[model samples]
Target chain A: MQSNQELEGFRVELRDWLEANCPAEMRGGEASESSICWGGKNFEFASDAQRDWMERAASKGYTVPTWPVEYGGAGLNRAQEKIFKEEMDRIGARSPLDSFGIWMLGPALLHFGSHEQKLHYLPPIARGEIRWCQGYSEPGAGSDLASVQTKGEDKGDHWLVNGQKIWTSYADKADWIFALIRTDREAPKHKGISFLLINMEDAGVETRPIKLISGASVFCETFFTDVKVPKHQIVGTENRGWDVAKYLLTHEREMISGGGQGLSGGRALGAVLNESLGEGQEMETTLRADAMRCEVDALATGLTLERYKDQAEAGTGAGDASAMLKYMGTELNKQRHELLMAAGGSDALEWDGPLGNRPADWLRTKANSIEGGTSEVMLSIVSRRVLGLGA
Target chain B: MANLVMTEDETMLADAARGFLDKSAPVKAFRDLRDAGKTHDAKMWKEMADMGWAGVLVPESAGGSDMGHAAAGVLAHEMGKTLVVSPFLSTAVIAATALRNVSDARAEKALAAIATGDVTYALAVDETSKFNPEATSMVATREGNGFRLSGKKTFVVDGALADRLLVLAKTDDGLTLFDIPADRAGITRNAQNMIDARDSARIDFDNVEATGEDVLGQVDSAMSVLKPAIEAGQAALAAEMAGLSAGAFGMTVAYLKERKQFGTVIGNFQALQHRAAHLWCEIEVTASAIVNAGRLLDEDPDNAIMAVSLAKARATSTAQLAVQEGVQMHGGIGMTDAYDIGFYMKRARVGAEWLGDYGYHANQVAKHRGF
Candidate 1:
């Protein structure tokens, strides 16, 4: 860990830089899902400020702060990056850009990608030129992800992809996808897999949006029929995609475990509850108690997350314990929403009122446990990996 | 305010404590103590004192190490792994905290005595309500400059063996704390055998005399002393509970691997594995909670009470579930006294209910949060 004096000095420099560069519109206190910028081909900026924010932050390599500078990152150490985030949060600055490319693909490429692959793929991702969506789960492979049936025939120079992926968040809008494709059909379920990156604009590729209960079309079912992917697009070894998939899943779980941090965009949860419940009115004791416990647990989880981050910075990634964080983090998020719903009462059900947004946000948390990996699967991993239980 | 990682000395202390307990007094030691109708091993208590645990919280000026609450918690956690029945919780933790926080010279003398393993103390705070310290209504009437305590204190842990009793009492001004010899006149102790095979007592304090110098802290401001003492006790208890649950969880996992059923070891079953995994996750969270409490107690004592409650609450419930699953997963043999799993279940129940149960601590957490 850096000395407090060094961190404080860095904070001053970072604060000055952000103040001079961050656009006024981009400093909006909280970001709605629709307001988030996901850059790609045909991507709408929403506002010039949005575009400028992404450009400036990316130019400074703030998009992926902790990654090496060679890969279009600020090359900040964990402590420095944390301090930078704290400064950003202090100003309630909205995230300059949000993309699966940054959260999922960038990490996988850095760890498992070839030097050439990192140079080719990571810079564009850091610059937000391409948006990415995951294709790990097919209709038949929700929880059992390695049992993917998406076959990628081994062509001499390229792979022929033929498969369908379900619950691909933002796949309809994404520029490309990193998918788990079976390269060797005769091998075991896990061994024959390959992680292939394919563009969404390829011929025979199509995506149909899946409407959620919240009436959002954020998710899509994607189909790839003989969409040719270059052999160079493969992430690790030809048939060792499971390893890459697993590694990416760790990052994905870490991202989801961070759901609590993003949900309100740095707004105080109590402020939201107060808006619905009416300030100064006494909340039911039981509900208040439940909220208190949830908040404390959230604080504890936040500390746990920091510990894991520090552990990762120390060169030992959280590994399977990420499952524990994912499990607890999602549950904490659901509980936060549950309390919000309870606080809103009948007003929370209003379709277009101030409290109306609580319902949809609460519903979105339902996927926190199910997506990435189900809570049950997470527990199974915790038991098997962390506890060394079972055969 | 939470220190996630332990200090190097703290980690060394924990390692040494665990290593010593593993060799000197494992679960088999607990078995022998129970079978022999003894709540604690005198030889092991002396060893712990020699290892400087008894005076862990006391200041170095008073012939003690003053390692702070977090280090003491490390040893407490280790002791918890073996279910080592000792006066560490009542005497070293609770009584020593009270002695360390006061200005009285007699308190320093008691601290030196505790350091030398010549004296042990049990805190008498609970009445009929079981674990609530604020429920104390025992009277201590003033006589000249001193006071005379008269009341009944039930559930005084290790009270039967304590050389002195640190009593929480009501005064004309407010609540106060006093430390008096267990052999003092008009103090009658009825020893009770607890379910966990620990020694507890119901004491009737009939006009027990106390000097002005015997007061643990300023009169009517005993909450200051009592609160930290209990917080220290709860932090240690939480760590112990974490240790107990971790131990039980480990034992159950081992049993699942060795105990065969139908055609294969039961551990091969996904159903059992998932349940065990859930328990393991619960234990991890509980362990973190305990660490947070210990760290907060040392780093930020002003707001440490809430973290203490959080730790005790989570550890209480987690240990309960761990012991329950330990027994259920072990089948019929777990129910028998011949197997060690049953002992853990019994010990967990006692530890969970002690100091404060889950509901009590959760309620405190809510109160502290202004809910």
Candidate 2:
């Protein structure tokens, strides 16, 4: 545990270090899909400078700063890690890698994986040597996630997986998937599930990219036909996969909620609103009020997040309150993008090249309310669990 | 950006006020206050004064804690929860604000008295059912040693009980605020029973005399002080409305869980659950808006007008929806006097219309936009 003074000092040091090391070219402006470095089996870079930048950050473990040193991480404590994030933000440093391996799978593996699992999976995840995508949602089991029909039958020495996963983000580019499969069809929907880590190159595994309104193949329909997942890859208890699924869902919600700050590149929401809507137009009143309302809600949600982060740093988890935050934050995020589209008006309709994706990006935000747990589900959880409204 | 969120100290103050209100001024206290036709409770006022709530916003140099408007908003919020019948808002916030903004020696001294709970004052600003303080029709004419004020002020909060009335009057220079003693000759206070049962008054200032030294601000510069003071008042009212909405929403939720319909808790139904969730979100957003307005009021008075107006509009709509939906969700018991929801709904209506209605504030915001 570090004092506020110590944290401030660490922040200043990290600030200085980032200022000297980070290249001016790899800074603040938005990175296209081509510019983004996803270091997996298929990783490539257009320029030697970009490749060198990725290698430098990866070698120093700055790519995953807070992960354990043994797995190519700086191993900084929570406070120091926060300071590192703030410093990186201050210097406008671009992340060396952006993938499910870094954001979703890494944390889940750290928490639930065996020692062998951690050693094999984490180093690659930290080194940006693997790209992962989620395999959770199905056409029939969107919000009612417990009703997943994906099955994993145990063979003599391996597990045979057979089912379809829809809305699997980045499945087309992913090298691995952490999925949920029913190991016992006779058991209850929740009890029959099991967590399995699967290789994307396994025989009979297929991925078809879904063309989203955002003009990008960010999600895909993944089908597993007799795909063999090594028995050793089963995480936690085979029959008790629901617990692992619940844990992952919490992290997923947090990740989606955290996505709020990442969408708008370093610009204050107020500034964006002002630019989109000309100053003091009569027609802009409703839009201005809505934008202001969203801004205030964002601030409130952000402050609530900071409070939770503080508590987490102090080793006191907010538990169900995190659900409250996730619910509010995702709604606020959707509202923000809606306001942006409203502000952009006709200009928002124009989609070509990169700008073509703006409309899709806006449409993708609509999924936020539906995914992770529909807004309705979150509210029900809050009412029953947090508010104690139902016994 | 002095953390718009509540600090530990602010939370402690809020919790203490909440605890006191729960124990002392329950729904019964509100009933008693309303039934007795009393504008405020002296015992509760003394308890609050003892707790230093009255001095929460007043400068310490003027016998106050000088904590600022954020703390005052918190106190008002707790007051709303208990439906505490008091002139805390009218005297401590509105009048004290006018005095503080005026920044005169006499006004400062008056504020000191207010901070100490030794005196109470009401601002007589509203006339002709408008939110504009500059539209005041009360006249202040030059007289021998001082001035004579003549005209009427409607819906003066706590007018019958206030020791001093900070009357907004039109002088030859322009609109001015005059602190006329309620007991002064030619002053008549007729107590009016509002729909919410809160005590207000129609005050007639028939050539009431007051010295130029009693003027609140530079003779004609009352608009500067009045506008911001009105904004602050609206913000405080919005805070109270937020608290009231929270209370009503909480009560409705509790009743819904306990009162079964169709052999299951009403709360178990998806329709009721979604409705309650939406109301909760609305209240949460309203709370943020009001708190933001309070912060703006303290830091940037120039933007306070817009912030407060926006907050008032949001809160008025939020409170109205929460109360109406709360009652509907609670079933038939909600409309009965025995249930607490009706009282909250009435109080919310009063708050919504107090400084300005939602439409009025929205129009004001548009006008401020130069539309």
DockQ of each: 0.38, 0.19
Interface RMSD for each predicted structure: 2.8, 5.2
| Tens-digit per-residue lDDT, B151-212, candidate 2 | 98888877888888888888887888777788999999999878778878898888788897
Q: Per-residue alpha-carbon lDDT of model 1 for A56-165, expressed as tens digits?
A: 99999998888899999999987797788778877878788778888889989988999999998888888989889999888889898888998998789999999899
Write one digit per residue (lDDT tens) for candidate 2, span A241-308: 88888877777777676666532223345555556555574347777667555554564455456555
- Which structure among the candidates has the greatest DockQ? 1
Per-residue lDDT of B175-249 in model 1, one digit per residue for the tens?
A: 998888899999999989788998999999999999987788898989888888899999999999888988888
- TM-score for each of the candidates: 0.91, 0.80
Please give the TM-score for the first chain of candidate 2. 0.89
What are the lDDT scores of the predictions, listed in order?
Answer: 0.84, 0.77
Clashing pairs in 2: A214-A360, A351-A356, A352-A356
TM-score: which candidate is best? 1
